[model samples]
Target: MQQTIAAPQRDLRPLLALVATAAIGVFAWLAVSTEFGHSLAAYDPAVTTWTVRMRHGLVTAVAWPLTHLGGTLGLTLLTLAVCALLLLRGRREHALVLAGAMIGSSSLTVLLKLVFARSRPAASLLLGEPASSWAFPSGHAFNTGVFAGVLAGFVLFSTTAPARKVLAAAAACAAIVLVGLSRIYLAYHWLTDVLAGWSIALAWLCVVGVIVLTVRRRPRMLPAGGGPRAPAAGSGRPRDQA
Candidate 1:
């Protein structure tokens, strides 16, 4: 006789917990590393040179609009709007995951900037002046990475259609890269700052992805004979299983 196969039940709570823990650990490590600080300082010159090159005439004009369009306010608002739509569509779990990714990355950016207290470039900025805070990690870059990476992860793992998923992934990557480039082009941050931002954001996102995958791979409850077990008393059917 043939045996019946059932889908696996994922426990996302563990993955979320793991991502949160790893995020905190990485942040703490970065905070305490004097060597990382020096390393970040060394990467500044290359970033500055690239920024100058990209800000010349036409490039500056084009990048100005693109960069401004992808600003923190714009990205945040866009993310929130999309998240609302996702939640309405019964994707609350994904929305929450994305939101966590955004909040975690942004919080770390602010905290690290405060701790480092590194100064922004003294030379004239290509696009605008810096006033908000010190430079060590680029908030723009970090936010871009977190937002884009998380969005990409959701699309890649959750979407059924291959074409749409690929397109979404491409778009997410483009957005992240452009935002990082914009920071350098606008001279708002050192190359080192942007690099550090990218690294931390990517690392955090990787941790998130790993957790999500771990949860997705968990075994579902099944009958001893190997089929989906009936729900006990009040446990309704697994709601979309994320």
Candidate 2:
């Protein structure tokens, strides 16, 4: 009888890279097309309707606070604080991957905004003055999408339990959708802008996810007998596993 050892699965990094590249191509095409312009023009009526609807009711009041809460720098700092905790808890690889995803996605959004030079919605429904920026891709939508998607990916990939994975995925979906809605309600971005932002952000997130999976699939060698142990609790050697 022959003995067999199961081979580890191949990494999904290449697949993610391919998806990310494809998404970029699609976003580039949309940015350059007259259709995107036409779409923006066509959406004005709908935007007005939605904006008015959002300005009233208890739901609007509730969503208002939560949406702006996510938009604040303090919330961003809190997220970073959590990432720091993950690193301290020996999840440095996950932390680095998430950090890269957030930073890289943000850079791409900025570059696209400058390159497209798209304008924001004419109407300002929100309490304060509107932001000044090229607005084809809504930054709030993009950032929220990337943050939620990457966090979900990390949770799904790292956790062994199925229920937790489902919860994380649900949370991600809710966050992305809510953020996109908030942008439209506030009249900060056109509908097409939010859609484009979401499409591109999701595509980039999938790419990053593939990369993470690919990295995780590779075999790592440990020293004989698990090598020297950490001298203190939570003081294990930090390796670039991801």
Candidate 3:
């Protein structure tokens, strides 16, 4: 009995670490984001000033697509497509986990926006960016972080090829960074809003990821006698060698 519990504890060490890290991130964001009516990441109007000032043709072109990709239709299609692919590959549970992670992040983003009711920067502050809604947490940054985190989890666990893993990780990380930066630069969200989004989604992924791992790693229950199941007659396999 003790051994059974011990085994699960060992298997859950990774999850414990992830949870600890996420707790710290959540606490830090909540502390910083709710202080004195502005967050450390967006304490200065100059931060927005400089970001708006950096707008140009090439950067705008690159940022437009990324923001769109993290948009409503784009994010929905991307999530469905990835979930569909995972289902096709017979990794049904992983597919579900992936879908749930992204969906949950998206849902929470909307809920938090409603709760905080933090308005975006003034229209006059906008250079070429769009800000037509609440801005406590950038939905794009939050959803993109979950997408990247879940995709990276799948890649790291499902594939063994070093090059493929590296490529996928790089792509996932790049997408997340670009999406967050786009939100900030486009003036769609404050810098702290993006940071809070990232923090929230990251904490969410770690939690969901732990649940999935726990389910997957559950050890098979043994027989009542505390031993492997005996093989059927004539099977020719040792019963104790399970």
Candidate 4:
């Protein structure tokens, strides 16, 4: 009975991957077609007032440092740390998946940035801080989405414990949200850029996650309900009481 239920759930994994792929396709279409340009431009700078406060020092006290975690080098190190943890846990395959997903997402962001060739917010709006990167999908948002996503996936599915899953999920979601918010507050990314980043990152994560789960699934010899199994006849087994 457990196998019967689990089989269907396993089958649905591929379909979920397909859905994520479709989302990526839609985002790419909108990007090339410029369908989101107007809204992106209009919304991009609307938060300038909030970020351009005179006490910018207060903002820099922690947010700027925290945002670096999404940067290429920072995220690379963090991914390695998680992979190491997974390795120590004897989940070598999951470690590989997590590493591949993160590294692949980072590379994708770099390539996409070049392909889009969209300029970052103008220097004037950046409060005199220099930001010299092409921005369509924010790297911070993309990397954070992927990293946090994989962690949450692990917490939710890799364990039998429910309380840990809920706690980890909440914490992971909050941290990822802060990463995106930090990007915007620093005048480093437009709203739509972060949205697109998240969209694509999630799509890719679903793909990687499904592939990993499929590859790592172990064969089970028993049903979900725990039950006793009688031993085969043997030479020395005692007969039933007469």
Candidate number of the best TM-score? 3
Model 1 lDDT per residue over 39-99, tens place: 4456566768766765568777777776665666877887899799999999888888888
Q: How close is candidate 2 to the true structure, as a TM-score?
A: 0.76
lDDT of 4: 0.75
For all candidates, what are the clash counts? 0, 2, 0, 0
Task: Please give the lDDT score for candidate 1.
Answer: 0.72
C-alpha positional error of residue 130 in candidate 1 after TM-score superposition, expressed in Å: 1.7
Worst 10 residues of 4 by lDDT: 1-10
Write candidate 2's Cα lDDT for 121-190 as tens digits: 6654554467777777877788778888877887777746999999999998888888787777767777
Q: What overall lDDT, based on C-alpha atoms, would model 3 receive against the true structure?
A: 0.77
- Those runs of model 3 whose alpha carbons end farther than 4 Å from true positions after fitting are 1-31, 38-44, 127-132, 221-242
lDDT sort, best first: 3, 4, 2, 1
Stronger candidate by TM-score (1 vs 2): 2
Worst 10 residues of 3 by lDDT: 1-10
Per-model C-alpha lDDT, please? 0.72, 0.73, 0.77, 0.75
lDDT of 2 at 145: 84
lDDT of 4 by residue, 32-106 (tens): 544445644565566655565533677766677778887888888999888998899998877877888887998
State, as a TM-score between 0 and 1, how close model 4 is to the true structure. Answer: 0.79
State TM-scores per candidate. Answer: 0.70, 0.76, 0.80, 0.79
Local lDDT at 1 for model 2: 31
